[model samples]
Target: DLHNRFKRGARSYTGTCKDEETQMVYKKGQSWLRPALRSNRVEFCRCDNGYPRCHSTPVQSLTNDCFTGNGTLYRGIQSRTESGNSCLKWNSPRLILKTYTAWKKNAHDLGLGSHNFCRNPDNDRKPWCYVLKDNLETWEYCDVPKCSTCGLRQYKESQFRIKGGFFADITSHPWQAAITTLDRRSPGKTHFLCGGILIDSCWVLSAAHCFQERYKVHEIRVVLGSTYREKKEEDEQVFEVEKYIIHEKFVSETFDNDIALLHLKPKADSLQCAQETKSVRTVCLPDAGLQLADWTECELSGYGKHEENSPFYSERLKEGHVRLYPSSRCTSRHLFNKTVTENMLCAGDTRSGGKEGNLHDACQGDSGGPLVCMKDNRMHLIGIISWGIGCGEKDVPGVYTKVINYLKWIEDKRRL
Candidate 1:
C-alpha cells in the first residue's frame, strides 16, 4: 500500500544554506541562490538520498458539511475544532496513549488509523478530536454540520439563479411549504396562493390573511420537500389540510395579528403527515425568551415573484438575506402609517440599493413564509412574512408576525 510504500522520515541533506549573493553551481548551470527557509510545522514526507520530497498524489475525500449514520461514513478532512485548534494526530503516541482510546477499537470503520481527520468514532454529538489547548490535552467538538437538524441546510451556489436573491434548493430551507388551493376554473388543478412553514409533523404555519377568502378545508393542499414553484420532485410530500385556525384577533382590514396554522392530514395507514428526510424536515421554534439583537442578519426563502411587476412566481425557490430592523424604524409611520402593532417585527435588505436597485426582500407570493435566524449554529424561526410596502423598495422593510410573541399560543393551539 502507499502508506507502507512511503517511508515518512526526517531528511539529512548535507547541502549548506546559501545566501542570495552566493553563486550556486549545478551540472546544468550556475545562478545566485537564496537561503533555505525553515518551518516549525510537522509534515509527512518521503526522503530521496536524504532529501525530503512528496512522491505520491494526495488522496482526499469529498468534503461535506454534514454527516449521516453516526458519521462512521464521514470521510471529510476537517482537522480543526470549532474554536480553530489543530486536531491532534490520531496516531500520535501522546494522543493514543493519554488522551484518546477509541482509535484502537474502531480505527478501520471510523477512518481513524493514522490521519488526524475529524471523525465520530464514539458517536458523540458530532465528530470531535483531542486538542492541546493551553498545553493541556482536552477534547473539543469539530465544526461538522448536522444534516437533519432543523434550520440548517446544504447551500449550493451557482450562476444564473435569481436577480434580487440567490436561487436556493429546498434542502437549504427544508421547512418551506407551498400552500395551494384547488383552482375553480380548472378541474384537478391547483394554484399557488401563499407560502407556509412546516412547524411540526402535522402542522404548518402561515398568515391568517392568506385564508381570508374562507376556502373549504378540502380545497387547500400543503406541499413540502419541493424546490420548484410548480413542479414536484419524487421526494415531495403532498398533504391535504385537515383543519385550519386563524387568529381570532386577526383583522384583515389592517392585516393585524396575521398568523394562522393548518393541521396536515396524516398519510394513509400512518399517524405522521411527513417523514423526515434530507430535503424534508421541521424547523425549530424559538423559545419565548429568545431575542436577537437588532440588525442581526437572517434569511428568508420562497417561490415568490422576482419583483412587484413580475407577473409570474419564481419557477424555482429563492433565498434572500435580510437584517432585523430596529423597532423605531419598524413603526407605523415607516409603513405608510399602517398599524405596526407590538406583535409585528420588520426585516428587509438594508443595502443602499446601488444603481442596480436590486434589494433582497420578500415579494407578492411570499406571504406566510418563514424568516429564520441562525442561533447556536441551528436555525430558529423568528418571523412570518406578513406584508410589505412593495417588493425590495428602498428604505422600506417588510413587516412580519413576530413568532416569539405567539409561541405559547401556537403550543396551546397545536395540541387541539
Candidate 2:
C-alpha cells in the first residue's frame, strides 16, 4: 500500500478506546486526542474510515491530556505532525476554495498581468493607461505624440526627405550644366533654348522670354560644360552668346518682366578643366530677404517642346516640376483691377493639366529659364522665366519673375 507506509516501523500506543487487545488503538476523541497527540513524531489520527489517524506518540504520552495546560496548544499540534505527509498531500480545502475564486475575479476586472487584464469594456482594447488628449485625428487613438500618418507639408517649411527620382534628379545642380536639343527647328534649324545655369566663368542665368523674337546674342550658341545638345562636340568647352541683359522691364504681351543675363565672352578653357567636369558648375543667387513661398519647390531646366509640335528631339536635359502659385492665383480679376503688379510667381496644375508629354510647363523654347531652389545643399537662384498659358493649360499658371522681388534689381545689376 504505498510501500506499506514506507516500511512502517514505529507503532506504539496505549489507549482511551479501540484496544484490539493492547494493539491499543483508540478513537472517540481520546480527550480530543490530547490535541493531536504531542509526539515522539508521527500523528494525524481520525480513521474509523473517515481516514487520518497515523500514530506513534508517547514521548511521555506527550505531556498528556489536552496537552496538560496547553503550551501554545502543545506546539501547534506538535508542529502539525512533524511536517510529514508534506502538508497532507497539498493541504486541500478544495484547493483553497479554487484559489480564492481566482483572486476575487481578477481584483474586480482591472484584469491582471500581461495586459489583457479583463477584456470587455467595449473591447478594441489598446488603452492600458497614460493618455491625456487634445487634437488626435490621423488613425485616431492619439493621446498626443502625433504623426500617426498624414504628412508632406513643406512649402519651404523645408524638411525634405523625399528621394524618388526623374524630375532630373529632383532638379539638378550637383554642379549643374545642360544642353539638350533633339533638333526640331522652327526658323533657322537648331532651336532648343531655355536652360542656362553656370553662374560664373562668364555668367548665364537665363529667361528674358528666352531672348524674345528668337535669337540674338551672336545668334545663340553657348553650350558650355554639356548636357547633350547632340553632345555639343563632345564638350571640352563650347561658348558663344557673349552678351545679353534684357530686364529693362521686359514686357512682351504681358509676360511681365522676365529676367535674363547671359554674358560669357571668354574664360572657358573649360575654366581650367572646370574641376574635372561632370555635373558642371555654378548656381548660387538667392539671398537678399529670400521670400519665394506659395507652394515653393521649384527647379525647371529645359530645351523645350518635348512633345507639342514634336519633331522629335529632346534627347535628355528635361526636368520641369514647379509649384509656387498663389499671388491671388496669378492676378486676373481684370488683372487685379488694372494695376497688374503682383510682380508674378504662379506655377501650374490647373487640375492635373500640363500637356506636351508632361514635362509640365515652360514650353516653346522655355523662355529665360532658371528657377532652381535646393537650399542648404546649395543651388539657389529662384525664379525668372515668366509667362505661360499653354504647356500646362487650365487657368494656365506658370509665370515667374519674383526672384525675391528682384533682389535690389539683382544686386544693382550684378555689381555684387
Candidate 3:
C-alpha cells in the first residue's frame, strides 16, 4: 500500500494526525448537531445550523433505574421475571448467544459492549456474542478512521534545487526537524541542539548521543516547517517534548546503534501534537528489506555549520546531495579509528574534489538529522547523521546510524 501511495504522486497526503478531533468545528453547508440527552436516550441534538444549538431540553429521569425502554436496550436490571428478556445488573444476559456469529450491528452501535467487541477472535472471549442474540442483523463501525499513516511526503514547491552549503527551503525537505534545548532558569529562549526526523505524527527519530546531557523532556523542543533558524513563519509549528527513549545498546565510545525516539505531547483537547500542512510533514520509514545500490543518489539537510572550523551554525536550513559509499570504503579504517559496524552506513560527495571542489556533507548541528533517499519517489529514511571526520573533507565520508538495521527495534519501542 505504501508503494502504491508513492506512485500516485502523493496527492492523498494531508499532514494531519489520524486521530479524531474533539472540538465541534462547523463544516460549511452542514447542520450543527450538538450532543444531548433526551427521551431516556443519549443521542445528537439537532441544531438548525443557521442558529446556535438549543439546550433547554432536560434529561429524562429513570424510574427505579430499571425501566426497559422501547427498542432493544439490553441494560442490566435489579430484578426480573422468567420471560427470558430481563436480568439483574450482576447476572448474565437473559438470552446468552454462544458465538461471534451471533453479534448484531445495532446492539454494538448502542454500545452494548463498548462498541469495540467486534475485534475479538471467534472464541469465548468475544464480548458481543451474547448481546447479539437480540438482533442478528447488521454490522457497522461508527466513525473509525478508514486509514492511518497520513502527513507523509510533503515538500515546498520549487522550480530548481542542491548538494552542499546553500540556503534551503524546509518545504523542500519537510521531514527535517530542528531539535532544540532550553534552560529552566531562563525563560522565553532556546538553543538549537540537534537535528531530527518526523517518522510518526507524535514521534521524532534522532541520535541517542544528542541527548547526552540528559536534558529533561520539558527542556527540549522540536521545531518543524521553518526555513529560517530563528524566524517563526506562519506555517511553522512548535512542540514541547513529552519524553524520549534512547536505545539501550548505544555505545558512547563507538556510537553503535545510535538512535532514539521523541514522543510529542498532545494538545489541550488531547488531539495530535502537530497538524499536517505543506510546510510540515513526515518521512516514510524504510522497510527492513529495502536495499539500495551503494552509489545511490540521496540527500541530507540541516542548519549545521558549513565547515568543521566554522564558529557559528547556519542561520537558515541547508541541504546537500550525497551518494552511498561501498562497504569497503565505509569501513572503520577509513573513518579515523571509529568502529563502523553493520548498524552504520557511510555517504559522501564523491563527485567533487580539489582546493575548491564544492563539497557537500553533513556536519556539526546536523547530528541526529535524516539521510533520506528517493525510494519509489517517496522520501524513505536511510540513516542518521552520527559523526564524521570533518565537514565536507576530501575522501572522507560522514558516518550515519544505519536506520534499516533498527527497523525491529523501532517497531518494538513504538508499540510500548
Candidate 4:
C-alpha cells in the first residue's frame, strides 16, 4: 500500500486513496500522496493536558510556504515547524470556491446535490449554521445548515415518539450504549452498571459514578448499534474500553461534575469503533456557546425500569420525554435534602397527579443515559440522567447533569 511505501522512505505515494468508510476518493498529480479532491489535510492535532501540541496558523504565519495559482495558500492554511513541513490548520478551510459555479462543479464530483446550498463554506459568516465535525472542524461545504449529519437519520427526534418501559424499535436510538463489566462481575459473566452515549467514533460519555468501582480498561465492555438488552443482534457492535476518564473534580457527596468519558478499543487492528450505519451513529454535542432554553421538552432513553420498585430493569430498551425545569424550581430545597448545584438541573412530568396523566422518567438502571433534544433538525445531547428523588414522582422531578455546562470540559478531553 502507499502508506507502507511511505513508511519505507518513499518521498510520496501518488494516484488515489479512497476513504473506505465514506467511499470518498482522494487523487493526486504527483509522485507523493496529495490531498484528496474534496479532502482536507488529515493530521492528528495532538494535544496534552488540554493544550494543542502544535499551534496552527494561516499559512501567512508559515515560512517559505507560498500561495497557489488561485492566490490561496498552496495547501490552504498551514503552519511551519522545525520539521520543514507545513500541514493545513484544523480551523482552515479545505478549499475556497469564490463563485457558485466553482462550488457546483466540485459538488458534482462528490455526487452531492449542487442545489443543496451555497458552495462557499462557513467563514466570516456567523449567523448561518454550518456542518460541524466531531474533530472540532467544519466541513468544506456550507451546504449543511447544522450538525444534522453528525448522527442524523430519516427519523426526526420527535419521530416514533417513544423508551422508558416498552420494547424499543431495533434502531430507535443509535447513540445509546450499555456500559457493563467486562466479565469481571463473574468468571464468565458481566453485568450492566450504567448507560452511555456515543459522542464520537472513539469516545463515549457516561456518569463518573459508574466507574467508581475502578474498572480496568479490559474490564469494561461497551455495546452499541443494537436495542436488545441481552440479545446479540447481528448488527450489534461490541468494543472493549481502552481507557476511561473521570472528571477530576467529581464529588461523590453531591454528584457534582459526575461526567466521565470512555475511549473505545476498535474491533480489529484496522477497525474503527462506532462505525456509521442506519442503526449506529454518534450524537451531536451542543455547540460550546449554545444555550438551550429552559422548559424545553427533551427525550431520554435507557433500559432502566418501568417503575421505581421494579424487581429488575427492563428487558428491552425504552425512551421517555421530560421537559427542562428552570433552575429556580430545580434547587436542593425542592428535593429530599440534597445539594442541587448549578451543574445539575431537574426534569419530569410537570402534570399533576398519577398514572394516566403522568409522563415517564428515567429510573434506577438508567443512570448515565442521554437526555437529547432536537435543535435545528438535529439531535443534541443536552443532559445526562444523574439522579432523582424517586421514579416519576408528582412533585419531585429527576435531576440531571446539565450537558451544556460541561461542553467545554468534554471538548477539551476528546478534541485531539
Q: After superposition, how far is residue 343 of candidate 3 from its true place, in Å?
A: 0.7
Kindly list the per-residue Cα lDDT of model 2 for residues 4-52, writing each as its tens digit.
Answer: 4323311333323332211223334532122222334533344342222
- State the weakest 10-residue window (summed lDDT) of model 3: 12-21
Tens digit of per-residue lDDT, candidate 4, span 1-416: 33532232212124444322222233443111122223343221221322222222332333432231222112222223223333222222432432222244453242222111222222222111123345442334222122235546546333343323345653667888988885643685888889999998889999988888787788788888767678789888888898889999999889999899998988776556777676777888888787778888888888887777778877678888778888788987899779988889888876554463235788888899898888887789888989987787777788888888888888888864
Worst 10 residues of 4 by lDDT: 68-77
> TM-scores of all models?
0.65, 0.23, 0.65, 0.64
Leading candidate by lDDT: 1
**Superior by lDDT: candidate 2 or candidate 3:** 3
* Per-residue lDDT of model 3, residues 100-132, tens digit only: 322334332232332222222222211122222
The residue ranges of model 4 lying beyond 4 angstroms of the native Cα positions read: 1-148, 156-166, 353-358
Q: Provide C-alpha RMSD values for all models, in order.
A: 13.5, 33.8, 16.3, 15.4
Per-residue lDDT over 193-224 for candidate 1, one digit per residue giving the tens place of the 0 to 100 score: 99999988799999999999999999999999
Backbone clash count, each prediction separately? 0, 10, 4, 6
| Candidate 3 ranges with C-alpha deviation above 4 Å | 1-163, 353-357
